[model samples]
Target: MSRLLLLSGGLDSTAIAAMTRPDQCLTIDYGQVAAQAEARAAKQVATLLGIHWSMITVPAREVGAGLMTGTATDPQGPPDAAPEWWPFRNQLLITLAAAWGVTRGITVVEVGTVASDGARHLDGTSLFLEAIDHVVASQEGHIRVRAPAAKLGAVELLTTSPVTEDVLAWTHSCHRANLPCGACPGCTKRRETLAAVGLLQ
Candidate 1:
């Protein structure tokens, strides 16, 4: 069965894509602020891994609720929460992937939500994934969701993933824009994690 990977082309998702080597990958542009950069990096990753790369552009800028969408939301969240928590983003992305799976007979939908990611966004939690898995299972098509790297944070990801160096060089994790602003949570985590993993100077 063909498996689909949600490739954000960031450190985490890119690492998963490289490790699992899925048959095909989907890069969604949900009208995010950095969709172009994500798509570019995802395409590169798919090419390098010899996987089919596909883009699904569904504009959702109107419902913007985070820095990624260039909108302002409640800046005050949990201590571990990042400022870029888009509402229902993970659910929407998974649903989109499941819809695509219906057409392609892909039964597996995988994402890259590390343990630390859950601390940042509630949707990234294992409970959310399990619930979504049930939802997918109930749907007509043996589809199920999985997060193989759900337990690993960035540092652990670097240690475990086969494409750590490539992900470091090619992935983009800027919430402000496609070109790493170096100030956003995404950029900071990437930099700090890379440094911790000894991949950065």
Candidate 2:
């Protein structure tokens, strides 16, 4: 059975994609920061991994109304507070990936959501995965959403996922990654997570 991975060109998703060793991968241009840049990174990583790759565009400005949309990361305050959320991004991404999987005879759709993602992202939770699983199952056994890192914290994922420096080289973790603005929340998170695993400077 073919596995369809949702590639985001971020550390977590890239790690998940590496572990899945999927037959093919799909990524979306959600108009997020570094959208095109991340797409380029995804293509690079997918090629390096010998996985077929395709790209899609999501109307993120239309569907996403959170900090990730560039509105405001933290209308409130604190590091792990208001701006930490991204609405239903994972659900939407998985739903689209599952639909594509069903059409391609791919039974498994790999996602990159991790346990530490709960600090800000609600859709990264098991509940959201369960809900999306039902959505895929409703279409029969054609597709299933898989979150390999969902049970693992960022430290565990970074430490144990089969991602090499080569794959990590293809990542664009900065939320404002035109040139990798390492100051953004996403970059900070990635740096901290990797540093926690002793992989970052």
Choose the strongest candidate by lDDT: 1
Deviation of model 2 at 5, angstroms: 0.7
lDDT of 2 by residue, 95-152 (tens): 7787667877889888888997765666777888888878887786657778888989
* Candidate 2: regions farther than 4 A off: 71-81
Cα lDDT of all candidates, in order? 0.86, 0.77
Give the clashing residue pairs of candidate 2, or none. Answer: 73-83
RMSD of 2: 2.7
| Best candidate according to TM-score | 1
Clash count, candidate 1: 0
- Cα deviation of 174, candidate 2, in Å: 1.7
Candidate 2 has a TM-score of 0.88
lDDT tens per residue, model 1, 65-154:
668877664444355556897778899999999998788889899998999888788898999999999998898996999999998877
Scored by Cα lDDT, where does model 2 land? 0.77
Local error of candidate 1 at 38, Å? 0.5
